[model samples]
Target: MNVFYEEAGTFKVGAILADNNTSLQIEAVHGKRSKIKASAVLFRFDTPPLAEFMGHVQKIAEELDPNFLWECCAQEIEFASDALATDYFGHTPNPVEAAATLLLLQNAPMYFYKKGHGRYKAAPPDALKAALAGQERKRLLAEQQARYVEQLNQFILPEEFKPSLSQLLYKPDKNSTEWKALEIVCTEKKLSAVKLMEKCGAIPSSHDYHFNQFIWEFFPEGTGFGELESQPAVENIVDLPHADAAAFSIDDASTTEIDDAFSVTPLSFGSFRIGIHIAAPALGIPPESALDQLAATRLSTVYLPGNKITMLPDGVITRFTLAEQAICPVVSLYLEVSDDYTVTGIESRIELIKITANLRHNELEQHFNDDALSKGHLQHALSKELTFLWNFACKLEKLRGKSNDTNNDKIDYSFEINDEHVSIIERRRGSPIDKVVSELMIYVNTEWGRQLTDAGITGIFRSQMNGKVKMSTSPAPHQGLGVSQYAWSSSPMRRYVDLINQRQLIALLRNEPPPYSRDSNNLLIAMRDFETAYGIYGEFQRSMERYWCLRWLLQEKIQTINAQVIKENLVKLDHIPLVTRVASLPEIAPGAYVKLRLSEIDLLERTFHAEFLQKQDS
Candidate 1:
């Protein structure tokens, strides 16, 4: 075979013609052609078009190829007489495309390194505190100038500079009410507060509270949230989640204003029809299109802690929350598959109708966990159809929705914070029920991603790095649900792309203008970037979660839990290993191990859970 390739259309050293007929000689010809033939050839290839070449090669006597040698050596360098080129100066940002890349880097197999380069190790941790303390000092000064900055390295670098009892108390609060009030502002600007506050070594103050206030910034303002406005009075009304006419508990009732409902019925062969109802954000949102700016800016709703900051205001997520009773816009997807899980059809186009999604996660969790609630309240108008789908494929269903159940590995913490006013049962688990629910969600998300990919539409997608990211890389498989492509569109209340995807689908369904560019390549690139940004969001969410979950975990005092390796790297015990910790051994797999280092609590990066992993045999 005539092998061919292209490299700037030129050749340099080591290009000697092989065979006794070919003395070690080389020549260059530009725009000139010459006829050359090797001894008898078993393969003949047409001169490859310029665009399709992989570099040129001719079969002369194949015997002339260099002898294969695999040699091991220590500390060796090959100096070249030629000028070192730019391509050699820096490595190509090798795009990683799979989980194996991270696995190889973490394990550091012998093949990944040469004989002389030995592993690097450092003493047990003294991780990231000195730096955090400096940061803490800076943030405190900026949050409140009046409060004397405590410079609490203890909190900043908990292990190295453990806080004294006095330092734990928040006393003599920031003199400026502005600091306190702005702290209440649940927006990124509050970081300005973190930058200004966090002074260490301070005594207790009445204002002391876990930094929960920051979460409010992530959401739209909710003044009358969790409250229902009355149009008139109804009979035998009970209390609602939002409406509290306590005195009028005389006859308070919850109204079901959800617009559309889903009906799924399993048919012969492995096929199911899906009905997706969506509430109109424009209805609750003012000026009809007023949400456009926010929809674009947020691109998607951001969820943190128990709080959710939606792209649109309460007027949308709730009032417009998908429901069957109220008229709503919806998108329906019907899919056919064999038991082996092959997508067979694209059924209905994106159909929009008024729908209700208010049966939200909590409500659903309750339906399964609470016996007294009865399954009736959870049933849809299309109960039979929905049940058929659930029965046929609850675990196999691809339209379930996106969420992580208790199974998502995390450092477990629960605070029996039985204060005079507050009592709560904190839970951090990767339990059975959680896994079942989460897996169902995974099925739906992955299917949605597939739909978008097939349509060549631009949209946001989410994927977890199967392991650590290394210098040379590829987009690792999304390990969360064990799927190739996982994305979300169930909620457009905040995510801009949800709206984009919804609009695109709506267009496709309505036979209107195509909302997304059909340029598959560009869309894929955008999707990749969106996924990367989502990773950053995950990190930020994890950092904040550590702060809150930590408070609860600390109060619970139930130390020790098993954890799994989300990513790992062999590092000097001195460095930090970034991962969430859980109290149960089940939280982590037993035999699986990865390089790790114990880290001082750095609330910012949340590097508290990375304890060294001992080899199982050890």
Candidate 2:
């Protein structure tokens, strides 16, 4: 006898050889013998053959209409498969018909709900309707996904994806249908999503693509200032004494946050007093004010090639920047120097100084460089003042024990971007302008740091210990600057740490309690936050510079270029600030030159591929 039975929710046919009441010995359709419980059998019959039974039942099941079966059945009540088959066919049903009926009833979950072995109950009217609608929705979505995949694979951007292009390209939602289809297309084309989108004209500019990605990650709240106003203009403006000198600031032309300036006054008998005036934004932006909170969050002005996000609002920066001809509020540190260029007296004051000039590096370098200074004459406005400062800065450098620092000759590259085109200008480090600015700023920072320490006030200091630089609430030595202590009090317009230190210094000058104490939570948090944000901003700046370097390479359309080996397999391209690794590079020492043949450049990925050609003689 052939028996159709259910095992593990699947139906199978086997030939029964013996029956021992509750148990039976049977051979399956595949000729494997096994012991089975008689209760497991759903139906028994003498068949044409056991092997063909299931195949015939399955075929018959397919032809059976499940809806018709459900309609013929009673609702919300259990019925045996054989009984249902008999009711449907209008006759006593055979084993094949019964098994096929059971198969259809088991699979059509929306039409019927199973009760027990070979028995089922019909679903209610509403539940079945909802299930069928959901199934249809899924079918339609599958069709839409297929169409999207097809269009994207053919290098076409679907019209429906236009509104979501930026979100999809930068911050993708994995469960989104558009992203799902894009994922499939990218896999089929063996390309990245960015590359595939660019090929499909979905991305307008690779530069914008990268920029939007950064903005999305770092400035998710958007970079716009909106209508947010700075803290109400400083009230009860203090009556500050006017300094007896005219001051000038030297910075890059693009710099709007002029932090430090200098003034020179000839005193009696070959002695002069040089004043380093720092823009005092801290006086206007009080502690815990809106502007202060905003500066705390940003920590520093974010700089990139051709663009920046200012730490303070533009209006506030304009009010405080040391622009020419404005009597800007300043924190002045004056040093009386003898004819031998040794400091004789040091004094600090809160004052207003009329800014005489805002000297930019490009034009200033032509008149105040090493060659021109050695020639002992310059045909410029601040020649006398610059000449005196140059001599004074030399004495300061010698006093710091770095009179012959090699960093003087190192190259510093600046990028000038105009309407999407870029020009890279190279300037030597430690130039006359750099020395004058750096030495004076270092002097002020060191002096102010010492003042805070002597006054027994805790402030943020930059310390270098064991060749690593870090921020601390307590004063410590900065070995790199050759200073016992270094507090960045000179750039309140640019850096948050400087602003915080500036507040502390201002309170000290006023003989008031310091705003931040030795263990203030706000002070500690600012230190940690500033360090992290500053590092992130620095890395982002470098990445953008690299992006522009690659753009410059493509813009110039040069096929071959020379690169200097910074280390093994790592080379910096000549005439630009780009550094990349060459896999095929031969073993070469640092500073060795290599010629490379350009192979490929991927701006979206910010990467390039090159082949090492030959080593060049030094």
Candidate No. with top lDDT? 2
Report the error of model 1 at residue 141, Å: 17
Backbone steric clashes in candidate 1, count: 79
Error of 2 at 126 (Å): 7.2
State the C-alpha lDDT per candidate: 0.37, 0.89
For candidate 1, report its TM-score.
0.42
Residue pairs in clash, model 2: none
Which tens-of-lDDT digit does each residue in 1-618 have in candidate 1? 231111222211222233334222322223323223222211223344332322322221122211111021112342211111112223321211111122222232222221211221211122324444666776775654323222222223123223322222223244443334334441333343333234432213211233323333333243222332221111111221221110000000122223223444455875654433333343233221434544443444454444444545554555554543344334444556445545566454332343332343333444333232235444433344434434434345343332333444543332222342212333334332344334434555566667656766544565566563321111224754567676655555544445555555545545656544645443444455445545655665565555554444344442433333443332212111224543222343433543443335434433455554443331
In angstroms, give how far residue 204 of model 1 lies from its true place: 7.4
Compute each candidate's TM-score over C-alphas.
Answer: 0.42, 0.91
